[model samples]
Target: MKKILVVDDEFDILTTWRLILEMEGYEVTTASNGRVALESARANPPDLVITDWMMPHMDGVAFIRELAANDSLAQVPVILMSAAAHAPTLEHGNAQFRRKPLSIDDLLDLVKHKLGEA
Candidate 1:
């Protein structure tokens, strides 16, 4: 099964994503912030990372940079989401940006596409 790490400060969102992804047959791990997620990823890297742009402890941009710096985790694809209208330009090529309030079906489709199942 493909493993996916989902990071979001909001408990509800995190849980929702975890449950939905698991139902789709993906092994899912979740973290409240980028800091925790990075630590977990270092110990056991996931195939993909889905993160929220704004988070406490560490934000998405900083997290992506850290992830990219690590050779072990650098190749993992990332999906970044935010409610903010302005999206930051990502230096990483393996990441895709999406605005928030997306439906579960759309999210699943994106996840599949990111994982090269599209």
Candidate 2:
């Protein structure tokens, strides 16, 4: 099973995503902020990372930069979500941007496509 790390500030969003991904047979791990997510990722590198753009302490962009700098985790695919009209530009090619208020089906489809599970 592919492991996925999900990072979001909202508790509800975190739990909801965990349940959804778990149901899809992915090993799901969640963190409330980018700081925690970074630690989690370093401890057990995930196949994919789904993160919120704005987060407390460390933002998604910073986290992605750190992840990219690390050789072991540099190749991990990342999906960044935001409520803003425009998503931030990422330097890494292994990253995807998605608008917030996302549909569960669409998110799942994107995850599947990124993980090559579709």
Candidate 3:
């Protein structure tokens, strides 16, 4: 099974994503902030990461930079989600962007595409 790490400041959002992804047969892990998420990723690197742009302690972009800095985790695919009016600039080629209020179907499709299961 593909492993996914989902990070969000909102506990409700994190829980919702976990349930949705798990139901799709993906092994899912979640963190409430980027700092915790980064630690989790280092401990057990995930195949893909779904993160919110704005987070306490560490932001998604910073987390992605840290993740990419690690040789072992550098290749992990990431999906960045934000509700902000303007999207943040992302230079990583392995990253994809999605606006907030993301549709479950769209999220699943992106995950599948990233994991090459689509």
- Using lDDT, give the best candidate's number: 2
Across 1-118, the per-residue lDDT of candidate 1 in tens digits comes to 8999999999999999999999888999999999999998999999999999899999988898899999999999999999989888876769888999979989999998877451
**lDDT of candidates 1 onward, in order:** 0.91, 0.92, 0.90
Candidate 1 residues lying further than 4 Å off, grouped into runs, are 116-118
Which runs of model 2 end up more than 4 angstroms from their true locations? none
| CA lDDT for candidate 3 | 0.90
Query: Model 3 compared with the native: what TM-score?
Result: 0.95
Query: TM-score, each model?
Result: 0.95, 0.96, 0.95
Summed over model 3, clashes come to: 0
Q: Arrange candidates by lDDT, highest first: which order? A: 2, 1, 3
Q: Alpha-carbon error at 52 in model 1, in Å?
A: 0.4
What overall lDDT, based on C-alpha atoms, would model 2 receive against the true structure? 0.92
Residue 34's lDDT in candidate 3: 89
Pairs clashing in candidate 3?
none
